[model samples]
Target: MRDAIKQLAESRSECTTRQTWYSALFSYNYPNSSETLRTVLDLLITARNEKTTQLQDTGLDPAVRARLQDEVSPLIHAHLPDPIVSEKGAIGIKAESVYQFYECDAGRAAVVFVSEILTAVTTELTHTGSIGYPLTTVLASAVGVHSRFLQASKKQVLDDLPI
Candidate 1:
């Protein structure tokens, strides 16, 4: 169980292996399944909230953060448009969605955005041995990506959830 949880955090681990681990958690038919699953879920939720707060408190101005997030929406929308119902009735994205996300225009933009950021970081590191790349340059690249999305038809945002 410990190893399985560790696998979830390893980027290079095979998706099938991760899926198997998730399945095991759900398939455990022991009397303690309910308590165990609840504990695991609470831990996951707490960790997520902490990370989100960290990101939200980053020194970037709120406007800059919002602009960057808007640029990233396309990739997120493509990747998570579908829901997967798991063995224990948990809803989530399939690991395979990672591959599918890179196939569309938004995904392509994400690739370019990532490449721009990586290039900026690498160049900065090679020249100064520091990660103090300028925020303006990153935001500029994001704006360029956002312009491309603007030319595409906008997706309607639903104001209300279906009952």
Candidate 2:
């Protein structure tokens, strides 16, 4: 029993093990895991980097250019709301002082901004692919890769578990 507990503890430290447990316990996986979020973000980043680099090339193809312009650029450049500093009274007086709320968690702010952009992309893809057909294709492929990674992770966790 002690050995079993120790083994379980050791396995829990593995990321795949934790992902499986999170999926089982929460009935959802990505939202609850920063690692999973990072995985998705990594896909976005890689696509952005590769395409942006290609865009910089002087001999870019017209079709690729259209795709990048219509699809990728808009998503990357999606506007997010500026942090509110304070609320003012009708008489133009400061209603109350605002703390350094926006300044406190810059990382969280970035994550929230990214999450909103991802949400917009997903929503647009689901509805009309209005972003662009090319972007939709790229997004679909990225999602396929991410799904495979998660499936492999879960399988690895199961394989590693004690019999």
Candidate 3:
């Protein structure tokens, strides 16, 4: 019947839309290249240091402190990509570009933590909506948060390291 055919077409269209949305969300969530992660990490480190210094200064008001903390917290949290290890026990996230800084256990832990966060973020985004604009916006927000968290974490690790 025409009604049945129409229903099938509609379902197919919905399915396609969902797929597209899912793909976009995942792509944004997982940086295709380690370079992307590295870039984000660098920015995060800078932000973390700046925020920490601001916090330490005596003149900052409570509102300013709150804002700075909010801005820096997410970047510190998002740097959690685990290193990809080879069969020979060589550990690295990418071979050439976006080299991971895993000289110590703290760095390795940061990567693992961020990776877990990414997975959780993707799942949360998928469940809250049907891969639509609202979902995309939410994912974008999460990406920003993760970026900040990763930066802060990196700074902490670097600070702990002996020069």
Candidate 4:
């Protein structure tokens, strides 16, 4: 978890998406609001604990790990005007939806991605003096990665829950 967090933050420093504008999932605000950051940290910690315990209890096989890396980690998207779910945005993903999704394999993978983002943000802040990195810079990273993970399972996770 520590290594993943550090590596994620380092990778974002080179994010090309900064050339264009973007925001975190369910948020229009740049960087992240304190409340939102808090929420992200909470989610990250929970995911860390969960995944850690999971691996400890049931070590992953090489094939299973490879499958997760291939199917669950990559960002796949439909090219066009964009998916209907994305055409219309929301203030944030419903917590209930995330909770339900947490029980599934895809959901767990998504959680790992989101956790990476929060971990990166936290790491950057640690070196930003007192004020920390600009919110814009924080959110400016390539939008499609972590957000994709969160969005990938949105319909299945959220189900009939309102956006």
Best by TM-score: 3
lDDT of 1 at 139: 49
lDDT of 3 by residue, 12-90 (tens): 3345333322110112223333444344445545656788888888888999999987655443322222232222212
Residues 20-57, candidate 1: write the lDDT tens digits.
22221112222122234334434544554444455576
lDDT of each: 0.35, 0.34, 0.42, 0.35
Q: Between the candidate structures 2 and 3, which one is better when assessed by lDDT?
A: 3
Candidate 4 residue-wise lDDT, 1-163, digit = tens: 2233323433433455624211233222222222333344345545544544554435688776565444322121110001111112212222322312121232243354354356445445544544535753455344445556655444342323211
**Steric clash pairs (candidate 4):** 31-135
Residue-level lDDT tens digits of model 2 in 1-163: 2222223333433444322221000111123333332233345546655777778877888988878754345223211111111111000001122101111122233333333244445545657645677777777666555545433222111111011
How many angstroms is residue 157 displaced in model 1 relative to the true structure, after the best TM-score fit? Answer: 34
Cα-based RMSD of the predictions, in order? 18.0, 22.6, 18.7, 15.5
Error in Å for residue 56 of model 3: 0.6
| Cα lDDT over the full model 3 | 0.42
TM-score of each: 0.26, 0.30, 0.32, 0.25
lDDT of 3 at 110: 44
Residue 122 of model 4, lDDT score: 49
Question: Model 1 scores what on Cα lDDT?
Answer: 0.35
